[model samples]
Target: MEDFLVNINGTLLKGPEAKISVFDRGFLYGDSVYEATRTFNKRPFRIDQHIDRLFLSAEKISLEPTYSKEVILSEVLKTIEAAPFKDATIRIVLTRGTNSDLGLDPALSGPNNLVVFTKEIKPNPAWWITDGVSMIFFQKKIEASGSLPKTGNYQENILANREATSRGAYDSFMINTHGHVTEGTTSNAWVIKNNILFTPPLADGVLDGLTRKALLEMAKRQMLPLPLVEKSLTKDDFLSADECFITSTTRNVVPVTKIESHLIGNGKPGALTLKLLELYLEFVK
Candidate 1:
């Protein structure tokens, strides 16, 4: 078994041997949609939801997938099985495919290419959840589209993340043009105040993250101590909140101890945030 496996359009290859054409629109113009999901004890978590979102993302960008959902899921499982890892992070990418003419028109592109890469999952630092991580507000406004797909075009996010890291922060929190806190570079933002949780609604141009969805569902089922509210939040609201946290597939629920210079809830992981993380892990199990 290999350390990692890459399955390109049904043909599996070693990680180092896997390659795609330079003419592929995904590489040339960043015309592609992708989903990243991780396994819990070798079993994929919420794989169906991930596949559903992947197709939706492709549809939003008008990029038709050559293979059906069943086929994609099958390939993901097959690749995971071929890899030697107790747990893995799976990334499924669907590119607009190759174009010999080097044109921007979708009609010029050939069949879409599907690529699945499965590799060992790298656990986050313990202090990230124990002591908590810090974040900085990204100056640039998020993309205006609320229904934006998880496409290959991530230059904005990449730059924001870079700026945050350079500034000694864990991640960058992005605000939309309306001054509403949308989300982090690759995670959904949440704030708790007076025991009530608040997060920017999908209307605020935030991605419909699966982890965020799971948290919301937990709140709906009364599993959380605080009632979750989907509302637009500004920087002021976040800075003054009693607790703050970010969620993603790989990171799960991690507390944010500070944003820029302002300390969040005593400059440590809040009790509610820890509880939420505990609940999330139980939910995952």
Candidate 2:
């Protein structure tokens, strides 16, 4: 814990030494944008893409970052270098700065603030990659945001995940108010059937995950006969799926062998799922 590194406004400090103002809009209101970048062999993987998404999210929320892109990239590298672990999970947070009053007005807000934190990356169990995971679905419509803004205001996911926990599942799927399959509590969902990979389009309010994008590219480059389709998905589609999985920055490709009462494809990690995962890992390295 003492070796953990944190960068607050370009100042490298210990995690315990880092602090932010209470009046910061990120604290008072959910006025912030963030990106989670993971490392492979101690180097950031696809960091450019993550930075692009971070800037996009900040633009969407009108949160101006004090540090330019170059500063961000350099500072992030420095923070990563300060970490003792060979692999890490790097999180960059840009807040709307602090304010004197509690008003929602941006003009009243102070200058933007940036925080970069690094911690040792913990690998998921070997069984998780082989046996996969189980999940439950809950219905709740969220209007799709194309860039997939992963903001601090993710209370919906928190509640949905709690629902999954009560049901003894690792994660849960959220169906939007429009009665469509949106995504997982914190990941993008994919259904593999008949050798085709199907997932919700960006219009469905699904986060355009960096890992998901990379996997799609890997699928194409490898010329794996499987076709990647981005379309609206439903419970019925999953109920008949041969295999299902979720993708995220930290978790990578996680097989979803079970959903609610239905068993997916003999209730095991499908062959194709494992193959794609192998290819994905190679791509990251």
Candidate 3:
């Protein structure tokens, strides 16, 4: 319900005042990477892992931030302190800075730009967690190389998600070129079959998500006979699933009540899905 602070190169500015150049490669060529996390009770959850992944993304794109990890974390904490929400979504971005010429080369002549900001997050709708959500399938364009993961080139996901929501779904279940089920537009997908949890592996061109790792760890701590496994998946795998769910920093473990025309597990949230949500609530607390 309030404006939050923004951190650009260590300077704290009002969210609206923080600005970057149009010539910045992030604007020019989509040469940027970002990480996001949501807070619980004003405390950002597993932000370190998010920052670590941000670094990994930078490395993948050959971006070397002049700021150290500690400095960036400190700036993020400052912005969180300025946010007035019980729950906030914090995002950090690194971009190739402005240069004399517009080019795709990484050897630009400007200092890399960093942006950190927090926004008030509304409470997740109870129905989203209880009754669950629906999704449609999005096939890749076939011409796009599409191997980029965790980068800022989100036009495809934006378009697919817009189309899916317009068609009465919350998001789209994306399919890679190999006909493998990859993930949701903004989440990592998982399914339960015969009481075992299954998800796509990183080799299937999915983002290595932090919440997914936490869930796997939580599963390991389960003495309740729950098993978690990662493997390649397809539309058939999801359509035949006993239960389906997705994980992200913001939407932790949201059950999938349906996928396209197929009703997942009687068109209701599954028992294991609810249990995992409880586990996640406790884990975050």
Candidate 4:
């Protein structure tokens, strides 16, 4: 693909040149909060919402932003303007700075903020939506005392996704120790049956995704009944699902056709998923 420019700590660098220090806790300890947003028609989409989520994530993780929201937005726009591709994904990350040689200082300096660094995320393929995709359950269980959802503590997801890929799957469903399907590696999971929408609750340890929240709001505005059943899901629950889909900032909404070896209803994108995707695109536009 084409190269892009990235602005980090007030410096503009090419995609390959953009780099962060290894000493940064975000790198060393995975102690950081991040948000991802995409562009539509070459313009940043829902930028304000994305920035709000970034700040919210930082707050949830007890990490303070090094710059104000306005400044961060300005920097992101600057980076986008410098990129080669007009339409692309933008990522904002904030990390805990180094603790220094003195070691373990709770009173350490404020967070080290890092801006854009040239990232791109294409939408799912046409077939992925029209035909839908299959999902496999990972062997690992979500941790009880997990890091804040905002933080980049995705070690469990990394492993699970790797396992899923090896198993010839499109996505991995992470089950909590209590047997609840929390979420996917990088997307929020949803299942529909008999016209009722069901997704794991935050109590199940799923990230409060912005896309998920927006879709839920849209459904409410349109007088759609969303009975959010935050209960555990079994393999049978997926097989019995009339429709299933995943949501994220980049993917928006993609259909899930199968769970493990069991095929969802008709092995085609469900009507509910199709409606959600159409509504979501209209909402975005």
For model 3, the superposed segments whose C-alpha errors exceed 4 Å read 142-149, 223-225
Ranking by lDDT: 1, 2, 3, 4
1-285 per-residue lDDT for model 4 (tens digits)? 126567877788876777777667776677887877887756888888888878887787777777888988888888777766656888777776655543445355445757575555565788987788888987555465332356778889899898888889988988877776778889988899887788777777777787888877776676344554545576567668898888988888989998889889999998778877887888876
**Candidate 2, superposed: residue stretches over 4 Å from native:** 1-3
TM-score (C-alpha, index-matched) for candidate 3:
0.93
Runs in model 1 deviating more than 4 A are 1-3
Q: Write the per-residue lDDT of candidate 1 for residues 126-196, one digit (tens) a residue.
A: 89877999999986654574755799988888998999999999999997888888889899999999999
For residues 1-285, what per-residue lDDT tens digits would candidate 3 score against the true structure?
A: 137667888787876787888888888878888988988888888988888888888888788877778988888888788667768888888886776787777776488788887878776789987789999999966433323446677887898799899999999988888898888888999999998999898877778888888887777787324798988899999999999999998878899999998899889999988888888878875
What would the per-residue lDDT of candidate 2 be over residues 1-285, giving only the tens digit for each residue? 565689988898988888889998889988898888888868997898888888888877777777688888998998888778778989999888888898999998878888998988889878787778988988764565454687878878999999999999988888876777878988889999898999888887778898889877866786555889888888889889999999888888899888997889999998888887887887788
Better structure of 1 and 2 per TM-score? 1
Q: What is the lDDT of residue 253 in candidate 4?
A: 90
Output the worst ten-in-a-row residue range by lDDT, candidate 1. 139-148
The TM-scores of all predictions, comma-separated, are: 0.97, 0.95, 0.93, 0.89
Question: Which whole-number lDDT from 0 to 100 does residue 99 have in model 2?
Answer: 88
Best-matching candidate per TM-score: 1
Clashes of each: 0, 4, 0, 0
Candidate 1 local distance difference test against the native: 0.90
**Which predicted model would earn the best lDDT?**
1
Which regions of candidate 4 deviate over 4 angstroms?
Answer: 102-111, 119-123, 145-148, 223-232
